[model samples]
Target: MSFIGIDLGTSSLKAILVDGQQRVVADTARALTVHRPQPLWSEQEPGDWVAAALGALHDLRDAAPSAFRLCRGIGLSGQMHGAVLLDEADRPLRPCILWNDGRASAECAALEAAEPASRAITGNIAMPGFTAPKLLWVRRHEPALFRRIRKVLLPKAYLHLVLTGEAIEEMSDASGTLWLDVGSRDWSQRMLAATGLDRSQMPALVEGSQPAGRMRADLARELGFDSPPLFAGGAGDNAAGAVGLGAVAAGASFLSLGTSGVLWRTTAGFEPRADRAVHAFCHALPGLWHQMSVHLSAAASLNWWANVTGHTEAELLAALGETVTAPSPVLFTPYLSGERTPHNDPQMRGGFARLGHETGRNAMTQAVLEGVAFAFRDGKAALESAGGPIMEAVVIGGGARSGLWLSILASVLDMRLHRYPQTETGAAFGAARLARLACTGENSGEICTQPLGSPEIFNPQRDLVAAYRERYDDWQSAAEFSRALQ
Candidate 1:
C-alpha cells in the first residue's frame, strides 16, 4: 500500500506519495499567499489551504496515478501555532492568526498576568505567535467575533476537519498553543480559562501516529481513492521533520533553515527552560518531548538580501567560491521578523553594521550568511544552556541546499552536520511515515528510523571555528548595540 503526506506550510501546500518500502513515488507543491492586512500581522484564509492541498494532491495523482490509487492512509503536517477559530457550523470565523504574527504582544503579557503559573504549565514563555495569546487578542479587540467562536483548531487540524469532519488535534502542534500542559501531554483547563476559552472549544487531542479519523467519503471520491483513507494525526512541521529525519530518539536533533531557523533536540522526558525562551514541548510520539531554539530569520535573510540586491540566490552563493580566507568585516543581525530565542523581543530589527568603501555585494552577501549562522549559534548556545546536548545535527530545508552556508553553519556551530539524501522532503516524508504507522500498526521506532541515504557529514574547520567564535562575540555586541538604539 502507499501512504500520502500533506504539509500545509506558510507559503505553500506540499504533498508526497510514499510506498510501503519508504521510497517517495511522487511529490508536488502549490504556492500559497500570506495576507498581511496590517504591519506585523500575518493571516491566511483556511479555505486557501484546503484548495492548495487538494490541488497539490491532484498534481500528485496525475504524476503517479497507480501510487495515488494505492494510497491507504493520509497524514498531515503544518505550520504550528496558528489560531483558526471556527463557528458552530465548523466554518472559519476569520483568517487564521499565523504563528509569525506579532499583533498579540499585549495579549501575551496579559496571559502571563492572568496565569502566573503559565510558564511552568506550558513550558514556554507567552509569545504573540502562540495560539493562546492570539485568542486573547481576539477576546479583547474583536469581542463580538470571539463570542462566535465555537471551536479552535491549528492550521493542520483545520485541514483534518475539512477532510474527516472531525475536530481533532495532535500533541506536537497543540503544544505550541500554550493550551497543552507540556508535562502531562494534555490540554490545560487553567491555561484555556486564562485565554477566555474552555475545553468545549478545544479539539479532541490525539498522538501524531494515531488515527484521528477516516477521510470523508465525498473527499475520497473526489480524490478518486477506492476507499476512505485512514487519517493519522501527524504533527507540526518541525516535529514531523524530526520523524522524517529519524530524530525521535533522545539527543537526536536536526537544524532546519527554512524561512525560520530551528535547532531541535529530542528528549526522553519533559524539559522546560522558559527563562531562555527555549521551547519545551511534547513530540509527536507518545512519551517523547523535545526542546527547540528558534531564530526568526535564517534563509529569509538571504532571500531579503537577494531581493534587495537584484541577484538570484544562485548568483550570490556562487560568489562564495568554496573557501573562507577571512571573516567579513561587515556584521549583520538577522532580526528581520523580530526574534524568539534568548531575547523574545518582537520590536527588534536587523541590519548590517561596519560598512566601508571596500564593502561590495560579495562582502555584504557573506555578512548576511555569516550573520544568520551566528544567530543560529546563539540558538545552539541557548539549547545547550538549557541542558540539551549537541552531539550532531541533521541539516534540512531550502538553505541546506547551499554548501557555503552549511560550511559556515558547521564552523560557527563547531558541530558536525549531516545532510540527508532528500533534505527538502523532511516534513512531508515524515507525514507519510506517520501514515504508515497509523495504518499498519507498526512500531513507530521501526517505521520512522530508516537510515538517511549515506548521509554527507560536514565537519567544522578548527581555524574557521576559532574565527567564527570571535565573530560571534562581535555579532552579540552588535546585536546589543542595535537593541540599545531601539
Candidate 2:
C-alpha cells in the first residue's frame, strides 16, 4: 500500500508518496507567500497551507493516480512555533504569527527572567517564537481576537484539523509551544497560569505516531481515495525532518540547509542545552529528544544571490561547482531573517566581509555557504557545551544539492557530510514512513534498514579546517561587534 506525508513549511508545502519498501514514488511541492504587514512581523494565511497541500495532492494524483488511490494513510509535518488561533467554528481567527515574527520580544524577555519558574514547568527558556509569547502579544495588542480563541494549534496541527476534522497536537509539536511539560509529556498547569491561557483551548495531546482520527470519507473521495486513517499528532517540522534523515539514535546527526538552516543531533534522552540556545524538542521517534540549532538564512542568502544574478537554482550551484577554489577569504553572516540558535538576537543583520574588487559572485556565493556553516558552528558549540558529542553530520536540504556547498560545509564543520538521494524529500519521506507504521501496524525502524542511496561523503582537509578555525573565531567576534548596533 502507498502512504503519503505532507510537510507544511514556512515558504512552501511539500508532499511525498512512498510505498511499503520505503522508496519514494513521487514528490510534489507548492510555494506560498509570507506576509509582513508590519515591521518585525511575519504572517501567512493558514488557508494557504491547506490550499498548497491540496494542490500538491492533486499534482501527485495526476502523476500517479493508481498509487495515490492505493494510499492508506496521511501524515503531516509542519513548521513549529507558529501560532494559529481558531475561532469557535474552527476557522482561523487571523493569519498565523510565524516562528520568525519578533513581535513577542518583551514577552520572551519577561519569561526568560522567570526561567527558574518557567523551566521548572515548561522545560526550556522562553524564546520569542514560543506560543505563549505570541499569545501574550495577542492578548496585549489584539485582545479582542485573543478573547475569540476557541483553539490554538501549531502550523501543521491547524492543517490536520482541516483535513481530518480533529484538532489535537502531538507531543513533538507540543514540546515547541512552551506549554508542554517536556519531562512528563503533558500540558503544564504552571505554564497555563503564567500565560493565562485556558488549557481547554488546547487540543487533546497525543504522541507523534498516535492515531489522531480517520480522514473524512467525503473529503477523501473528493481528493481521490477511500478514507484512510489520518495521524493527527504528527510532529514539528524539524523533528519530523530529523526522522527523514534517520537521525534517530543519540549520536546520529544531520545538517539541513533549506531556505533556512539547522544542525540537528538526536539523543535517546532529553538534554536541554544549558544556555537554551539550541532547541530541545521531543523527537518523532518516541522516547527520544532532538536538539537543533537553526539559522534564519542558510540557502536564503544563496537564493538572493541567484535572484540578483538571474541564475536558476541549478545554474547557481553549477557556477559554484566550476569555480572550485580553497575556501574563500570572504565571510558571510546569513542573518537575513535574523538568527535563532547560538545567537538568539533578532536585530542582527547579514553581511559579507573582505570583499575585494576581485571578489566575484562565486566567491560571494561560497561565502554565503561557508558563512552559514560558521553560524552552525555556534550552535555546535552550544550542544557540545551540554555534553553532547559532535559526530559526522548528515547533510540534507536544497543547499545540500550544491556539491561545492556540501564540501565547504563539511570542511567548516570539520566533519564528514553524508547526502541522501532524496535530500529535499527528507521530511515527507520520514512522514510517510511514520504514517505507514500508523496505518499498517508495521515496525517503524524497518524503514531505516536500507541506507539512503549512495551518499557522497565529504571529509575535511586539515589545512582548510585550520583556516576555518581562525575564520570562525573572527566570525564570532564580528557577531559580538554587531550586537552593539542593536
Candidate 3:
C-alpha cells in the first residue's frame, strides 16, 4: 500500500506518494502567496493553502494513478506557530498571521513582563511568533475579529478540518501555541485563563500518527481517492524534519537551513530552559521532546546577498572560495529577521564589526557563512548546558546543499556534521515514514531508498577552530552589548 504525504509550507504545498516500504514514487508541488500589507506583518489566506494542496494532489493523481490507487492513508506536515482564527461557521476571520510575522512584539513583551503568570502557566515567556501573542494583538487592535473567534487552528489543522471534518491539533503543533503544557501533553488551564480564551476554543489534542479520521467522501472523490484514511496529527514541519533526519531517537541533533535556520535536538524527558532562548516542543516521535533554536535568517541571508550582489549562489560560492584562504577578522551577525536563539531580541541588527579596507565581497560572504555557523554553535552550547552532550548532527535543507557552508558549520561547532541520506524533501518523506509507522509498527527498514546524497564530512582546521572560538566569545559580547543599548 502507498501513503500520501502532504507538506504545507510558508510559500508552497508539496505532495508525495510513498509506498508502505517508505520509498517516494512521485512528488508534486503548488505555490501559495503570502501578503505583507504593512511592515512587520505577514498574512496568508487559508483557502489558498487548501487550493494549492488540492491542486498538488490532483497533479500527483495524474502522474501516478497506480500509486494513488494503492494509497491507504494521507498524512499532513505543515508550518508551525501560525495563528489561524475561524468564525462560528468555520470561516477564516482573516488571513493567517505567519510564524515570521513580528507585529505581535509588543504583546509578547507585555506577556513576558507578567513574570508570575507567564512562567507559571505557559511554561514559557511570550515571543512575537507565538500564537498566543498574535491572539492578544488581534484582541487589542481588532476587537471585533477577536470577538468572532470560535476556533484557533494552526495552518495544518486548518487543512485537516477540510479533509476530515474535524478541528483539532496534534501534539507537535499544539506545543508551539504557549497554551499547551509541553510536559503533560495537554492544554494548560492556567494559560488558557491568562489568554482569556476558553478550553472550547482550542482543538482537541491527539498523538502525531494516530488516524484523525477518513477523508470526507465528497472531498476524497474530488481529489481522486475513495475515502483515504487521513492521519490527523502528522506534525509541524520541524517535527517532520526531525523524523526525516532520524532525530526521533535520543541524543540526535539535526541542523536545518531553509528560509530560516534551525538547530533541533531530541531528548527523552521534559527539559524547559528558563532562559527562553530555545523553544521546547513535543516531538513527532512518541514520548520524545525537542528543543529548537532558530535563526530568522540562515539561507535567507545568503539569498538576500545573492539578490543584492546580482550573482547566483554558485557565483557567491566561487567568490567564497577566493576569500576563505585569507580569513577576515570581522564579525557578521545573521539577523536578517532579527534573532531567536540565545538572544530573543527583535531590535538587534545585522552588521560587520572591525572591517578593514582588505574586506572584499568574498571576505564579507565568508563572514556571513561563519556568522550563521557561530550563531548555531551558541545554541548548541546552550542545549548542552541544558540537556547534556550533543555531538552528532545530521545536516539537511537548502543550506546543506553547500559543501562550504557544511564545512564551516562543522568547523564552527567543532563536531562532525553527518550529511542527510535524503535532504531536500526530508519533511515530506519523514511524514511518509510516520504514516508507515502508524500503519505498521516497525521502526527499522528502508523509508526511502533513493538517498538524496551522503554527507561530505568536514574536519575543523585547528587554526580555524581556534579563530572561531575567539570570534564566538566576541560575538556573544557584541550581542549582549546590542541588547543593553536596546
Q: Identify the leading candidate in terms of TM-score.
A: 1
| RMSD, one per candidate, in order | 1.1, 1.8, 2.6
Compared with the true structure, the alpha-carbon lDDT of candidate 1 equals 0.91
Q: Rate the local accuracy (lDDT) of all candidates.
A: 0.91, 0.79, 0.78
* TM-scores, each model vs. reference: 0.98, 0.95, 0.92
Model 1: weakest 10-residue lDDT segment is: 444-453
lDDT of 1 by residue, 367-386 (tens): 99999999888888899998
Error of 2 at 339 (Å): 1.6
Best candidate according to lDDT: 1
Worst 10 residues of 3 by lDDT: 443-452
lDDT for each residue of candidate 3 in 1-486, tens digit (9 for 90 to 100): 888888898767888888755677889878778798987777899999989888988888898898786677777899888999999999999999988788888888766664356654445557787898898899999999999999999999999898888987888888888888888899987777666688999998887767677788887777777556656368889888877666776667888877788888887877777484778888886688888887877887887778878888789887666225434577787776677787776666677776887767877788778878888887787777777776667777777888888877877888877775547677787777677666665652344232455665656667777777877888777666656665
> How high is the lDDT of residue 355 in model 3?
85
TM-score of 2: 0.95
lDDT of 2 by residue, 50-147 (tens): 89988999988988888889888888888888999999999999999998887898888765564457765665667777788898889889999988
Ranking by lDDT: 1, 2, 3
By TM-score, highest first, what's the ranking? Answer: 1, 2, 3
Report, for all candidates in order, the number of backbone clashes: 0, 0, 1
